[model samples]
Target chain A: MTTAIGQYQYDQVDRDFLAARIEEFSEQVARRLDGALTEDEFKPLRLMNGLYLQLHAYMLRVAVPYGTLNAAQVRAFADVARRYDRGYGHFTTRQNIQFNWIRLEDTPDILRLLADVDMHALQTSGNCIRNVTSDEFAGAAADELVDPRVHAEILRQWSTLHPEFTFLPRKFKIAISGSPNDRVAARFHDIGVIARPGDDGRVVFQIFVGGGLGRTPIVGQELYDSVPEERLLATLEAIIRVYNAHGRRDNIYKARIKILVQALGVAAYRNEVEAELAQMDIARYRLSPEMVASIEARFAAPDLQAPEGAAAVLAEQRAQNMVFDRWVRSNTHAHRSEGHIIAVVSLKPPGEIPGDVTADQLDRLAGLSERFAYGELRTTHLQNVVFGHVRQDQLYDLWRGLVDVGLGAPNVGLIGDIVACPGLDYCALANARSIPIAQKLGARFADMTLQEQIGALQINISGCINACGHHHAGHIGLLGVDKRGEEFFQMTLGGRADDQATVGKILGPALPEDDTVDAIARIVDRYLQERSGQESFLETLKRVGEAPFKEAAYDTV
Target chain B: MKRAVRVGAGEGLVITANRLLDGAIVWLSADHTWQTAIQRAEVLVSDAVSERLEGVQSRAQADGVVGIYEIAVRPEVGGPVPLTMRERIRAFGPTVHPQFAYEQQEGAGA
Candidate 1:
């Protein structure tokens, strides 16, 4: 192997394997294009790298877990945009980027380029393993028990082209949440891992399995109360092996782990995972302490010296700039450090499509990450960017920079803090456009005072029920449906975004386009009028039930 | 008069498919006059572009100013379709979802 950059580094064996795979695929594509290879022969090769041709031409989706990227990695994406794609990329609600147009010939080069930056399209698509996702605020969130990224990365390394598990019956998705606030939609993934402090004061994961949305949406079952940190990877391997051996391969839709879990029940599935775990050769497959240490060392945060006069600087900014202060209050979360705060950049502006960042905006965010946030950039599942370690002193400067770019809205946890997917407009799967509805809702609640009065509400919009926007997790969820070539929306209320999360209950009949925003306004207005001064939206909705909200939402002219 | 327009991102070109048709893909050129490569082409192909332009075209005729044919025009799928402001808005979906309750059910069924 080539000299290791560090322990647990990307060795020559890995690089050579990937390179050979790319060349083999390239040759396969060449043969197909030249009429030497049949579609059957080429299918497996394309499936290996997460490339797929749907009803339209080929679409290549690259998974970015919980939307975390360093400056260098962002630049690499920019390279992919400039080189392989048509100078732009579409970011999906799953924290992935889809390049809709791609020639089969150039895919190998794209893979090679991605390999250079320690990324690949491996298992991003197809009917086998998919990329693992975690909370975007994992390592940096003050409220997190531990960084879920470590576990996600570990899973990613283990699952990448594992011979035994590459050909599962259907696609599998795993999401982990480090934050107590369920930001990663853990309950909706095939496997959900939530990090928590165990009895021994060590961080362990509570594992859930089988939750998914498609033709049938079912909440996942809790498989483990707490799995020891050391045994996490082995336990995951066991789960996969069990699913691979028994999951239905006859009907493609019934092949997902969700069906397996449903068929076996949670108790049986747990028993199976345990049985498989007991049979595994732990000595051969387990991650050694040294390997774990090496990976952890690579992710160590830079030493940040506290800025002088940070509090006074923030105080002055807050006093002089109402907009900046509102942004800081709504969009910025407190950091563990005395002077640093995590500033979120909301992409959900009124009337704008969700997760639609322009190339110029991406470049600017990358530059800002380098300048004011110690070069760390994170994309939240709520469709926003987090400058993980921004100093309080730089708040005004950062706000000014964001304001110039039309991103300085302070509606983070308020009703305006909306999470939406690109609906019918861009997605072949969507029934309606979710962005415009989200935008209108955001603009309606644009007043900072009103937003603060509403307080800590999540409004999630999904074009369809695939729940890409995690509508189920929102306190107020909006789902789009198409009626006779016309768009309609359904409202669900009383959902939670925390540990005791529940899917929102649907209100009444769908409202008209012009009336929907006002309908939401009426709901919020009723909450404001009826709620006790300190009660949040979810709490108020729970106490009053759906009757009041339903009445308010539909009573509008 | 008939014209073709390159809509969305990629290689699939949309043709008027016949003379005197107006679809969202049709537009004025840089010179402030109607022009379309797809409408002007002698042949059209069944490809990604054709699939995208399927319903947005006029009926094909034996002899018309614009003709729609399906052929494999190009092998490579280009990037996102560069949409006009109007197209971008349409691409986003309806302004509200509740307005079309029946359509929502159909979408879910699909």
Candidate 2:
């Protein structure tokens, strides 16, 4: 028997809560359909429930909190895809699933189905605090200091229907990281929480504020060096309260906490938050050590099995099959448990839409999860699925299963593994089509050997300046713009979203869609020439200072 | 004629809106029926385009469509075509997913 840990356990109370929410939304949808409520009034209500009317049809975003999902939930998602949406669902950068072709009327039934599985789209959209994201390798990764899922769950519970701060100037995002490597882009969130070793060698939450992407992409500043465990929630509340009171309400563009923090400066912002904290009853928001321990206790331990001589057998298999060896190396992470590995199935196939999984694939992956990972899985912000507890011997079988289902592309962080938003294709707020750009690039670098040679490059593409695809965080970022009537793309270089989080700067003037892909290939060729030994693309760019790459891109174009 | 659009092309105006019940893209046809085809839209060729637009906007506010606006079209060989890329995309479909386009669909795929 396998134990389910770190995944939120929903009781009857939680089920009741979801049912009530669905009932309320169902009534509102009815009122809108019957002409009792105008579209203006119903827009916010539909948005709160994660329903959006796009260029073609309605889109529904379902929150997978901290990217956690069970086998049953995956199957349910497959059902949603087959029954409600098109044959596929798109996983977003925020670790949420977006069904692109939802009808406005079918949303009530979708919510009811989700509620049956102890899921709902509350706070997935709207001005309220959205779903809390974290490292996908939360509890299973060997390098993690603490599982950030515990804290992420806390944020999810506290922020849901938070009446006081629900209607803030703009939407709020929070991300947590317990790993030394910041995989979740925590630094780019409105509130970034890093579980760090304090002076006493105990875990203390390092608080960051004002970091965000979009029109004004700003890296957050460390608000507190070390906040004690009991004070995490209280400190966060104070910080949010400050933003709610003073954040710009007039201009939609100047409404994010980043703008307010930039305007007031970090020092002055801290003083306001500190003053607010001093006045408030800290005890009310205190997340006591005992409470945290209890919550941790609620999580069931993984009943991992040890297969005799599994590693030796796997080594034999790898020796026989070089292709499988490359896949094993690229697609798995170091696990916390002995003889166990974290197996990631790539959702990105060469020349296909990034983060899209078909209904058939979802159902099959659910079965695969049950066989290898104790029926538990994770969705990464990079748009991949993780089987958190696979034994060494089971990996080969799992790999074969994935290949059969077409989820076995071994390029997780390579150039082929791109991040792109639904730009002009489905989104109403887009200037150009992002998927075609990704498709052209992915096709160019389709060869596995070529991608491996390119070595850990992220190419993010956004349809607009909104940065939903996180163009600011890519090693090679492409922002799509509409010049006159045609599509043009702006290129950026030397950006990364790891521990050393930094934004990419524009390399050269914008190029047409036809020329942009070719220009990027030229830049990659320039990097191959500029690099010394096994230095990364970022290292090469940082050393050469965008001069060679800039020349390589624009000169040819 | 005087709205949030770039002035271009030849002929006239056509009222387009997302039908309230299902959010389907609909165009005001020659008989003032809200049909799903842009080709069937009534093209107003007269100088009283502003008055016609106002009447449509008011009627749109009170009825079956929510986001209602007029599209500037050029009378092409096939039918009246939207001037801007935005309207053209709206008229045709999303470039990436051609299957989801209104024109390409077999009765809008249920």
Candidate 3:
């Protein structure tokens, strides 16, 4: 018999807890079923897991699918606020949003409302499936072998309350990545899928299951061979079903699929998955060609005419304006089209918390999207906003407008583009304040001249290993740890954000809060001093290794 | 410093469960005062004074001086009334615990 993907499954005792919760919710629902409990009485239950209702009393839990939202999605969120909520929605660090002012009596009506717009809170708070997340740059980046979004979306549809998979022991989280360069923090997810091309020209996924970073941090085990595209959804269903049957249920923490994967050796897990796939009625649940076609059609890039003389225009801008040229080089990337460029709005400003877009800024971005870019937005896992289609001709205008709003910092891929979460200030789970640490580091690297010299570097910070800020994927990752009730910061070097993704190694002991920024500066200065010309930060780190930087970062301190 | 008070649009009303303790709907008035809008089916005085409301207790604690309550309010009838709060702290929105009132009590000690 094949073992489960993760060794831990809910036992009979765990089922008792799940049943108790269901009963509790059922009682609460019954009390308000016929409008008995007023709005005030029903709010606490919703807020516990970041859920809210919108206009017409429809419930909407902002999916924090890893705290990455694009300018368009951010704007669309504001639109959702205006249209559905009362022009205001609360942001949660789980990378989700919630509108608290909803009518509980109209929950089903709201679910229907979301379904009308191809959106639903389907397993948002339930024990069933949840939103499948991937690196926001899945398709657009120059380094990816294949877009992981197609796979993520495919999995998303398949797992939306699949009858057999819904009543699992506990919540499950899945993250996918094509960027081996480390865009998505794959190591800390229940099931982390990394897309790689095999020697046979087939797209293979290196499956890491049962890895998570909460109270217990463990790296996932690989449990699959090159799972082909056609069999991806079916394979995932089998894995979930296996976990549903075998995952631990006694303790909530142990119920995660990660524990199950850990308990079962990778070989055993793989064997189980293979056996389960073999026994399944694949045709019944397999994504049909027509369904795939319809979904792909919706995600298809919008048609646009290529602006003639785009190259010459960029060349002229570069020759005359160094600032504009630097921005274009760092912040803009070549689109599949001849004249269009995808622009990333780096949320990392020196001393600014990543992924926070103020209400006013949200409005301005909405206006900009309608004007320059086709009203499409994408949020990157690196905690930045992206405009998918921007014409080269409109680049200067967009940049100038963005500069007016204090968003035209050309540090998109540079050292200054830090990803940080709202730590102790807002998060009930955080042990230390992450925003201040990120702010301090951002201030240290605020100089545009210094940033240009360092080139593209991602510095991610997490208040805790829930990894909300994606600290595991950064080229230079900083994690906030609590020591004897005191806040301390740890630094990791050589992490990357591209297709050949590798988690950074820890550089000796953790630093005190006071010396954290300077320690980072020392590391950067060391790279500047020792690196050969044209060598990026990751390349320099790999070539010279973390020894030199570690010596510089800690020895003097 | 003068705090700015504006009539922002009435976002949806948030009704929580605690206000329904003993099956009564509790609410605060616009003037930062505790008052019962409804109690036990019958209209006990067409307009009851804020003081006569049931379970409206005030105290000076280590945190600050504030009122703790389990009062009820209904719109026109003795049912769940969705009253919109403006510039009122304690009754700003529907919350999980009616006990957790939003008061400027933090600055009261200061």
Q: If candidate 2 were superposed on the true structure by all CA atoms, what would the RMSD be?
A: 2.2
Kindly give the stretch of ten consecutive residues in candidate 2 chain A with the minimal lDDT sum. Answer: A1-10
For candidate 1, the TM-score of chain A alone relative to the native chain A: 0.89
Candidates in order, interface RMSD in Å: 10.9, 1.8, 13.7
Writing each residue's lDDT as its tens digit, candidate 3 over A185-267 gives 56666778888777876567887787665555566766775776557778888888889988888888788887777788777
| Per-candidate DockQ vs. reference | 0.08, 0.56, 0.03
Highest-DockQ candidate? 2
Off by over 4 Å in 1: A1-18, A37-47, A52-58, A82-88, A100-109, A197-202, A511-515, B1-110
Cα-based lDDT at residue A353, candidate 1? 54
lDDT of residue A528 for candidate 2: 92
Q: Which residue runs of candidate 3 sit more than 4 Å off their true CA positions?
A: A1-49, A52-61, A64-76, A79-128, A138-151, A177-182, A185-188, A194-208, A211-222, A298-300, A497-499, A543-545, A555-557, B1-110
Model 2: lDDT equals 0.85
Best-to-worst ranking by TM-score: 2, 1, 3
lDDT of 1 by residue, A1-557 (tens): 22211112455777787788778877876776665655566666776776765212255777675566766556667777777664556566666776644656677788788777655677887666677777766666688777777667777777777788878888888888777777777877788899887888766888888887655666778888788878888888888899999999999778889999999999999899888877788777766667766776656465666777897889998999887887887888777677778898887666555566656666777778778877767776676778878888987888888877777767777787788876654455777778788778877887778788789888988878777777767788888876754678887887664567576777877766678888888988898898987998888877888888888998855
Best candidate, lDDT: 2
Q: Give the TM-scores of the predictions, in the order they appear.
A: 0.79, 0.96, 0.70
DockQ, 0 to 1 scale, candidate 1: 0.08
Going through the candidates in the order shown, the clash numbers are 26, 0, 51
